[model samples]
Target: MSTSSNSIARMWRTVLPRRGSVARASDRFQAGLLIFVALLALAALPVSAAIGSETYVRQQGESAQQVSERSQVAATLLADGPDITVNSRAGVVGNSRLTDAAWLLPDGTRRVGKVVAGQGRLKGETLTVWVDRTGSPVDPPLRGAGVVIDAVVLGLGLWLGALALLALGYRLAVFSLDRFRFAQWQHEWFHQLDRKTRS
Candidate 1:
């Protein structure tokens, strides 16, 4: 199995573009590590979201944005269409027959509507909005899956970093012990050499 795997790896090396082989391998390893980390973070995202903390706050914000957009579109459409007598609140105040366009804000109610560019007055059928201050929903919304992805990625990085640190620490400890052993061996050798010279 090992031989076959080695042969396959050699085959891949031959097939791949000839550049700096070491660099290419390092780059590939780095890319693989990054992908691994991302997957882990993704898995962790859900757990974080489940806490119903900042995640919930952000979700609510997105929802509000979606609602607001819908409301704006509704208002704009109200002026665009003919008055619906069946629905009293559906249509606006003036005949929003928009041939030209203009803006109006004589009162605190700032509005732009169909009016001649040079014309003084602005006019648009003011339709009664049943829901006021309604915010827009978060389109392309983030869900649990997204949350999970985020968490998994974060977790993966932490895990990898920890593993790396452990490996490094182990290497350092081994190196220190080896150096101490070598010093002791060298001291003993020196003493024997001196005794032999005296003899």
Candidate 2:
């Protein structure tokens, strides 16, 4: 038989009590616990999905707000950016640097500030920059792809963490059960020895 079919048959034998089967009470309990863990893992799926959906919605709202508040403008570099450095072991380094630049605000007023520019860029080179209402440089607005990725990562992480906890609990329970079964066997062996000596 296939491995999966063999596993299923073994599970059935352990989970279901038979009239003349050698399965012990502990064995049945362990099987029940295993089934319960599997059920809990299945139940966690919908819960994680719900949480991820909520996260996606909330993040999309925030991203929309950011897009509304931010503006992109062309800025001209006023000075040379830091030169790109090469390392013997790291190859090319310093891909970005803070450089003086100027851009026109919404009101047609010019604003001068230090903005992050590509390394080795010379003066007068133009680059797109994101700014807020006050013309202060800011990070670009969050994208839809980022929101989806965040939600998926959070959901997957939560599900995996739940599975880890369940597996740990099952292992601890099995360890305790094995210890109890060993002690019971030891006690039975000594009791039979005592009875034989007394008789």
Instruction: Pick the TM-score winner.
Output: 2
Residue-level lDDT tens digits of model 2 in 58-114: 999999999999999999999998888899999988688789999999899999999
What TM-score fits each model? 0.34, 0.86
lDDT of 1 by residue, 1-199 (tens): 7997895566456445367565344334433444454556565555444443554456566656644543322222223343423437764344333332222222335343332112122234333232223232112344556655555555555555655665565556557656776787799999999999999
Residue ranges of candidate 2 with Cα displaced over 4 Å: 190-199
Q: CA lDDT, every prediction?
A: 0.47, 0.94
What is the number of backbone collisions in each predicted candidate, taken in the order shown? 37, 0
Error of 2 at 16 (Å): 2.5
* TM-score of predicted structure 2: 0.86
